[model samples]
Target: MSNEVRDELLTVYAAMILHSDGAEITSERISKLTAATGAKVEAYWASLFAKLCKNQDLNEILSSCGGGGGGAAPAAAAAAGDAGAGDAGAAPAAAKVEEEEEEEGMDFDLFG
Candidate 1:
């Protein structure tokens, strides 16, 4: 793929490819992939990208394109259910927690 380079983004794309291919994304590997695609990736940029991604959980990050909190609802519900089974007084606490969670989402409303 001898295409024109798109600067820093090329390095990021190459890193993603390496990650999906189950290859270690070192600066050398990023440089090689960018070069293979005819992109002249700077060595410093490659190293910086490698460093930035060193501790990232790429699999976790890619698992949900829609982002997080899906599991949180189910977990919170289960906790409420479990607590409700034992104590009647615990129900209000659970409801309060849910209300707090909802209020947090309303902090930045789309239609202000």
Candidate 2:
């Protein structure tokens, strides 16, 4: 493909990735690429972006990007609670002592 087409495609891909969460598009990101490259390129990029947004992968990406815990927080908390219950019901003191000993032996300095 020609440089013009490549640049347009890149811009579209970058825009889709950057704007995944309905972020405002700043002028600094536009650089020189724009929708005026060609009607076909513009249409293709729009279709690609639409398809990506419609897929479940977009949700996963957005959830991971949101940094708001998403669905993982509850699951992790439940698992941790279960583990604590199990530990409490079992030998807690023995396990805790071993963990402390292991931590004491861990390297404090990267070079060491």
Each prediction's RMSD to truth: 7.8, 9.4
Q: Report the Cα lDDT for residue 1, model 1.
A: 42
- Local error of candidate 1 at residue 5 (angstroms): 9.3
Give the per-residue lDDT of model 1 (tens digit) for 1-112: 4323465789889889999998888999999888898756667778988898898998887775675548698888788789798788888886799899999988996788
For model 1 the TM-score comes to: 0.50
Question: Model 2: residues >4 Å from true position, as ranges?
Answer: 1-29, 32-60, 64-91, 107-112
Q: What 10-residue stretch in candidate 1 is worst by lDDT?
A: 1-10
Instruction: Give the per-residue lDDT of model 2 (tens digit) for 2-98.
Output: 8667755666565665576465434333332354444334345544544544434554665677556477868966776777885664446656887
Segments of candidate 1 deviating more than 4 angstroms: 1-5, 64-112
lDDT of 2 at 92: 60
Global lDDT of each candidate: 0.82, 0.56
Point to the candidate with the largest TM-score: 1
